[model samples]
Target: MKGVIRTILLIALICIFSIQFTMSMVIFTDLDNHWGKEHVNWAANTMELIDGFNDGTFRPDDIMTRIDFILALNTLLVKKNIYQDVGLHFGKGINISYTDVDRYHWAYGELAILATYISEYGNADIEIKEIFTEDTFNPNKPINRHEVLLLSRAVTTPPIEDHIISFKDVDANIPNYNLIIESVNNGILRGYSDGTLRLDKNITRAEAATVLRRVATDVNYLADKFLVYEDIKSRNIGIELPIFQQIDEHESQSQLHQRFIDAITSIQYSAFVGHIPYHERHLYDMQPIETLWGLKNQNYYNVIGNNYYLIKYDKDLVMERKKELVKEGLQHLKLNVNSSFDGLISFLSIAAELLPMEETMNAAEATFRQSDNSKTKLETGLFIMSQYMANNEMDKGLNIHRSLLEYEFADDIKAQIIRNYGYLLYSLKGADEAIRILKDLKDEMDLDFNELNPNAIEFTFNGLMKQILIQSKN
Candidate 1:
């Protein structure tokens, strides 16, 4: 049964990531001919990061409040799992003791977290010091243009070096000149048609969303030109494996479980080998346990008997089965929104979205509110971080990945988390830290093989470390 469950999970992982790509475009009524229209849509629709007001107006021209910006920022941070303490103060029955902002205000936790993050890690060189040093957050006040740009730039990496400010209204004498110059050079900050940057004016909500969108879509389009599914398949040379003795049917249940676990271990090694054929052979050879469980036509099911529906999707079937599963997953999430089934349902819905089905987005949104077990919560957090990475939100992803180390997970689970965490560290923090973490992970792999089920995460651990070392030198 566990073997079947593993197969189903692997299938889902392959389906969600390897074989799907389609994104729905968002259309907002208020964005017609707006400079920030594409950005707002990308933020709202593709990234699931923002929304329109109840009447459908985005209020592009209205001044955006300080508290409201933080709230939105915090949501994106949490969705990306960037910081562990992000929403801690906002948990149930928690009271914030700030002097100006009421505990009941919607932005309380966000304000608290932002204040804490800035006070502790904020760049001292930036000119935006008054707001942080103030006793009150003044949550309702509209933020000035300079403050918005400063805050937006803060969430991302500061420029490695300063650039000369060419905008007529800005120069070395201006406050936050370095940050402003960096933002403009990077296209995160833009000048008006007249070439004057309105530094002191209050930015609207639509404008703020557009700025966030700029950070989110900063990836190099050229890098992904060769990353299609067929490219992966074309790179594969078939794998050959030594024949294994048949499993004895007379073996006890425990013995069968042990053999299947061994097969799982082989699957992990196959991933390191980076061969699709080896991975498939391991899956096919695993003995299926006799049970009154599992899906009717498929090979795996959940512990309680829910089927994992993934039809073999060659070009012939195309999206037929995936589309059906997506529909089913959304229905499950809608039906089980606040129930105990939320985590599982949410997982399925999110998996569907890798196919780029927007219908499952609500499931991902609703997951933030649902009560989830530690395992589900951890996995969900990982998924959220992956979304951030997908959208070019690397800083956010780095935080979330780093924070996962605080949890007490089973050795196998921790190993998987470390692999992802290590990758992020390499991408964001540099190689020394990533190399240190991965090296420490080697000591933890000395678990008793007799009692533990085999996990493949450790198989690629050395390979990943080597890769990071190579990249670091370059």
Candidate 2:
């Protein structure tokens, strides 16, 4: 009787396996698209569920809003039975807050507690009223491209090694930049042909789905199953079908589905993988001075300056080569500086018209230091002040402008300085002071309308005027 009972139990187990295998095959027929096609062959053996909108539109371009991410996450959790069979409902409410999020917002209460991805400064409670800043969570704004990469890294199990996705653009100083880079190294994501990760751009849904599928396969939560999608051609299915088949048969349905969702949501919470090969290439072979002469790639120059310091003495013999390259680069820069001085002066003269206030200030400072003649210094100083009104460092710029006013210079240069100073005061949210200064300059000089190079004067004046007008209206 004991042997018969054991035999009966073994038969029941076989029947259950047969049933599960059949269910997996049926599910394979439903998956379609690049992501589905890749995993379809193995999906029958794997019990993973690939989740996204049913319409076959991955929406790779749309931003993942907070609500959308929460819904996707909850769907994964529900499938996984993470909350248990007792059916503890993931409550939804509009009025949840812990002094950060707005009570009336859609994801105000539920997502914070349920996802638990973010926590208050010192506790587990959600900070509801907290406005999302660059370093903090901002629910409403479109997530940047780099954030998606970081999120993917976080959910990934047994985190990847350091320095995999090396990018020229990502500063090492950025928080958790290294972790995100490692995820790319581990084959979790990829970067574009361009050397930049474009961290500021928003991520789309299709991109997220593709990432999810890759992570799911890596984690052993998916089965290797062969599948064919109606929309995806046989040639395009490639290796993905077999991978899907493997995961489908071996894993539970809930596990497969959760992995898919996790992949999709990873985009908004991670750093972007940059062009690794190119970055390494530039690092090893310092570009020739001629290469940077009239060079368009300022980013490349910045990388060289920041990484291979020409100023420092090092035990590495490569340091000598770097210093020689820097000397050559400086020679080329000097030529450009001299040849472009007049153009630069013209540009600086009407900086308010052509450049941002910050840039204008930069040009002004550069000119003042580089100019050999006192006349040029006075002119550059006036231009600097004119453009400096919009700067956060306006007080510092003003002080320098006042000092220039004491110097004896050519009448033409001095007049330009006075006119520019008046314009600067006007632009710096000091309309009353600006009017008084402008009146004095207008009274003192024979204003040459043509000498006011339109290219130099128009752009800055118009831009400042527009800013002033907008501010006044607000």
Candidate 3:
């Protein structure tokens, strides 16, 4: 009975200790005022990815050196077994080639492994030219804010929507401004509350711990790339297809959206035979809508809907029609930026991708600048920005939209400007920004999810707003 009692007590004690450890296994004394305190604790105590120099003091604000980051990265991969995913085995095949880092160096094994990987496999997760200009491994060198961008992008598969953030200090023409914008968008780098990126600054120890924790724990970082139907293709299988198709006479708005998703994502079973689905192509965060369609048969129909239709969509027909559209769209460029409506859209889509954006943007900028009427200027800006949204050239589009919004406008024009901006945000999967921008409009306006496509069958504007809010929370 005494033994049994002792065993019960022991089990209870173990469970309590585990609960405490799980709650916060390592507490840092210096992180009381730091924004990344929790991340520091999680990375240190939970994942064992980082550690304090001494008992209970994490020294969270100290600048991290290159070696510290490399070791933290090594721990994240090796200790947590994420290295298996990347096919990295640290000790073997390591060559101590860096002039500064000898085999006896504290971080030699990890540093050597990284060196070997980079030297042999020129195509690393990030471009080699982005980092490592020389043979000297400056392991103790303080990593700059911009350098973290190179590391974070290599480590985390976060979304890459540029011009998503701006700093008061960063000018658009500066060499690093665009990179900083993208880094902020990726959540790898953040700005001060006062709106400065302090681009020249080195990241503190606290910041490094948080960034490392993000790579270790953030869902967006660890998520697998997937194929949603809309990513593979679109509504038209080339040629002219009617907006409404093979009737689901009583389909709900949700069901209609699902149908749209299914149509673009579907394929004939025979067409799937030699294709490798779920390919692990996670070398870098893919740009939006990028997918691996490495298939033996490249031709697949963009089946319009679930139900049968009168038209035949052969592989050859589909390919030829798409080519013709591109060709026609290119030919429409004869009207140049002067084209209106569909012709204008086609020109923008093709030209934005084909022509040098400098030339295209220069011509576009002149048109808006030359317009004397506020309405025409707004319309031109909105039109060009809309094309940018459509073509996934959101960074350039965002710049155009911002310039338009800064101008003083009549209330109605201002409302339209705000709405157009919100619609562009919505297209970029920026649910929060979309809602925020739309709410800025003081009057009743369409909040529908049909900004890009007038005939898009989705939830009502309010419904979609609510849906995305719920999703964002999740």
Residues 16-49, model 1: lDDT tens digits: 7754533244456687888877667766776677
lDDT of 3: 0.51
Lowest summed lDDT window (length 10), candidate 3: 225-234
Cα lDDT tens digits, model 2, 141-254, are 565456555554443332322344556777877766665565576455667788777777765554544555544433221111111101111221221211111222234444
Residue 113's C-alpha lDDT in candidate 2?
44
Go through the candidates in order and give the clash count of each: 1, 75, 1
Candidate 3 lDDT by residue in tens digits, 1-474 = 999999999999999999986666666677887888777877788777777876778888889988788788767756555555556677755566667867777777886665554444322234433454468878889987767765555444334233566678878786445544654665666788998878668888888887776555432223322111121112221213222222233344444444333432333222344332445223222221121121102222212221111122233335445444434433333333232221232233334564567655555566576654343345456556655666778677756765776565654445444444445567674877766654454224433533212222121233334334434544
**Pairs clashing within candidate 3:** 60-206
Report lDDT (CA) for all predictions.
Answer: 0.52, 0.42, 0.51
lDDT of 2 at 175: 64
RMSD list, candidates in order: 22.9, 28.7, 18.6
Q: How accurate is candidate 2 locally (lDDT)?
A: 0.42
Model 2 Cα shift for residue 56 (angstroms): 7.1
In model 1, state the lDDT of residue 72: 72
Candidate 3 residue spans exceeding 4 A from truth: 1-24, 79-82, 92-97, 102-106, 115-125, 132-135, 158-160, 164-180, 193-195, 217-225, 228-474
In candidate 1, the residue pairs with backbone N, CA or C atoms under 3 Å apart (3 or more residues apart, or in different chains) clash, namely 81-400
